[model samples]
Target: AGSPTEATALVCLDLPSSQVEVVARSSSVAVEPEYLSIPEPIVFPTGGGKEVAYAFFYPPKNRDFVAPAGEKPPLLVKSHGGPTGATAAVLNLGIQYWTSRGIAVLDVNYRGSSGYGRAYREALKGRWGLVDVEDCIAGAQFLAAQGKVDGERLLIRGGSAGGYTTLAALTFHTVFKAGASYYGVSDLEALAQETHKFESHYLDSLIGPYPERRDLYRERSPIHHLEGLNCPVIFFQGLEDAIVPPNQAERMVAALQAKGIPVAYVPFAGEQHGFRQAANLKRALEAELYFYAQILGFPLAELIEPVPIANWPPPR
Candidate 1:
């Protein structure tokens, strides 16, 4: 069942009262193993002298293509959604999509992220933007120090809560040169005032009681700190997103454009918090890849039609 290329298995566990049989499998599709980079676990130091965990995936092996000599591949630091959610070491085509095209990915499981026990998950309490942002930055620095990725060409991206971290990193730090926010939160205060019932009180734990500590919210919200954001960014939003709403992305796009930063925005009419439709998903992935290639000055292996970017300088 366990093979080098792919594996499938069925096992039975005998309990005191009954036997349970489960089927586990990997896709049989003929995706070349060389086109996929195995996930490597990493632990690095972050703020407050604490450490965080992440999984790093290097550029894939492609016989037909090679990067320019002496050029380290650009790194894309991915922040998984949920701030509570964690990135898994699964065979994800989405991660593979970037790796196969010569990009390195660091899937961060930042502090306050789940799966590291209740205490770590609670580490984000009253420090949503700070802990997550510092952990992500630390992961990128660790990789760069190891000479595994190009330090100058670092990019950060995420959706939902992860999107919030992406925006925070780009706004508050100078480490990332570019970013992509997929339906990310730009205004924590706005979110607290307008989010759905389920998350209406969620920030009370993530930040503090609303209105009581609203100043902290304003300080952490990326929209309010736009003066510090100078890098290129592309955003993808679902018009029907109720949790974060369209305005989250719209306002950020507007602000970046006003500052003459390179920016692009894509909105899907019928989508929600996360993209569901296959077509929209495909479009989002291709657009992000194209956006990064344009900003990082790299050639994409695929022939994706260019997505227009505002303030993008003409090719020299």
Candidate 2:
């Protein structure tokens, strides 16, 4: 079946007449066409200005709501998992959740991401934090320069390796105003030593052999450089996660608490790695949106349960 718009549908082929027939749809609820944002493939300069990175930019769209004139929508830079993973032009309701609510989404395929060829994927070797972080920053800046998003409201989020990129960006650079991490790595050295056997040596090529290049691990780790991350951040973590253990999120939350940065932590008890339970997934999404609304000063169209942000508004 052909999908001209973003949606989940069912169809069948009529081989005898060489025609297509609609069988059904995945969802019972009908989403108006005007509410779905189309993905636009974008290529823009990397931080060095030498090479370009790829991404799918989804601008905000909703028939019932419109931003005030001259107001640029906030941009959410999404770092996909696997660090080596690449994003695609598929229908993703998670992305739509942000766009339909007036937030633009930039799904980045930074250096080392797959689907771009071998050399591109290898570019992340020994340069995970540096290369990936720069590409994400570049994508947001590119959108701002193009007048597509508000420069002041640039935000980021990622899970697993992407989560590492989000932490690195907020820690090492001043570009993103705030960020969210879904079980992201904060300490590279810890990750190299603590991760499961399948991925135990994963960082060997990404960074270097453990202990042999321990210096690089410490240097690139966001946990070690928490002093640099002053902005607000919300963390969603599955308490049972083994890939990126709960410690990763807890450590950062603890540091943010001590430093008085506005931070929120939401942990799911029975879930592991990526959320599997339907209710937990929905809760996390709504919590992140609520956190953003409070931090960005944008009013939500509907009520959502509030997530507690520590150190917000500064006590008099």
Candidate 3:
């Protein structure tokens, strides 16, 4: 099952483990690098049926057929942007850095995403904020059930559409201990009302048609629901980002600050939606890791180029 286009429903099968030997499921089309082996699809029981989530769990190497003795690894629930994009085990030097350090990363291909065919991709249609948020929550739940991730040290991070899910997960749910967003959508209504040509009409598929679904655009927006967000968040955005203007980043920063949440907003001057300059990218990565380390009480790995938080301790 696959989606040729973006923001469509995903179509998958329910293969009961009891009949695994008899049932056959279609394979995914994502290409894997020569050095890596992709993990299998994981299913979590949703309302009535199972909601299939695509993920890659890289664990530490076993020692001489003996279980390693260490605390459960910190889990990072990664939500990819595009809301239409699927989280594949793509080759990345960063993912390696974390896994090598014994961190567990769960990249979620949530509802309303592509690569699952048309039907499953459409699972988020007209249910934008609520459905996608639920998927991330479920992904975390799946990790905790495995008993390998520290439930108390969970983090959710994403970019673009992925950022929107992160904001929603932090605001609408309490599963994550902290979160980070890169040029994510803070206001859905503003995006629908003030987007560029390529995506001006894109909301028609993810949520609903313009003018008709205007209410949804407002209600699903995280910016409008800042009052409900109480967790620590660190956001990065390019100063000149046209896709998600600096104002969106500023507003969220302001709201979180006013609510007394430990929030850090770093906008790279002259940078666009995606940070490309090496210095800026490096700063963004280090800053994000620093934020999570500070909030989660994780071991500090030589805090490089740290961005000091004015109000260090979060209000209890």
Candidate 4:
């Protein structure tokens, strides 16, 4: 019938603000340790030139969250595995486990990481320890300046290559109170000299060809600087991890401990590069959470099993 009368034409509608209602789901949702945070991504300036990328896991507000006009919550910034990896807005129960307890989590994607397209991802090529570590520190600063986090209480953690970032950040920056590196690389020279085939050539672009940039490897490795470290640190390494052998964590812990910096090294047997088993992952996460609470003095609601880390900072 007459082309179905064209069904419809343009229509104008004006809605009144008086009629509009806004409700913050989180504003009403009770903060819980398992899923109370929102994942957000933020970009920050790089010290040299390129931009750094990061994903934030914001905790549900106190609803009555009154900041006393100047106070801020503590922050836990994380880095993902694979120096080539990116932190998605994925629902990592571990992240929420912290947020629900009044912590903010930042899962960072440093230079040489993936998902920011190719150009940003390759920025760390031939400069692994420098750009990657700097970017992470920058992200923390950015969040602090936003009045979102207590800068002095900054914490950084990472797994695999991410662990490498955590170690570098703690070694290079003074902002972090504590840090955890999960099966991360500590000595580039050793890694390039003895790692399996898959990663043998990977560092060629990450740091430089082995033996050629040997100085650079030693210069950036965190294990060498444990003498100067004064912060609390913990390491989680899978005993069977072929990528970053347990020896890496062992050396780091021993060195840091010798220097009197609080350190805990847990090398789980039969586990691989990353702890995939539920129990191992669970213990790793719980241990890290409790370690931070004890070190940083932030009251964590969840009961973290006692994994004694000797000489931890005076508890809060």
TM-scores for all predictions:
0.90, 0.92, 0.82, 0.82
- CA lDDT scores, all candidates in order: 0.86, 0.90, 0.74, 0.75
Per-residue accuracy of model 1 over 169-215 as CA lDDT, tens digit each: 99999999999999999999998999888766889999999999999
What TM-score quantifies how close candidate 2 is to the native fold?
0.92
lDDT of 1: 0.86
**For residues 1-316, what per-residue lDDT tens digits would candidate 4 score against the true structure?**
0011111223333475435233222122233433345566687777654555655546434443333565687888888777787666644556666665667877777777777777888787887878878877888888888878898889988887788888888887787999998988888777887788866688888887778878889999988877656788988988888778888889888877777778887778889987878888889888888888888776666566878786665445
lDDT accuracy of residue 74 in candidate 3: 81
Model 2 spans > 4 angstroms off: 1-30
- Predicted candidate 3 versus true structure: per-residue lDDT over 222-309, tens digit per residue: 8888878889999899888888888998898888787777889888888987777989877887888888878877666464777766
Model 2: how far is 237 from its true place, Å? 1.0
Expressed as tens digits, the lDDT of each residue in 166-252 for candidate 2 is: 999999989988999999999898888888988769899999999999999999999999999899999999988877889888989
Q: Point to the candidate with the largest lDDT.
A: 2
Model 4 global lDDT (CA atoms, 0 to 1): 0.75
Report how far off residue 305 is in candidate 3 (Å): 1.9
| Worst lDDT 10-window in candidate 1 | 1-10
Task: Rank the candidate models, highest lDDT first.
Answer: 2, 1, 4, 3
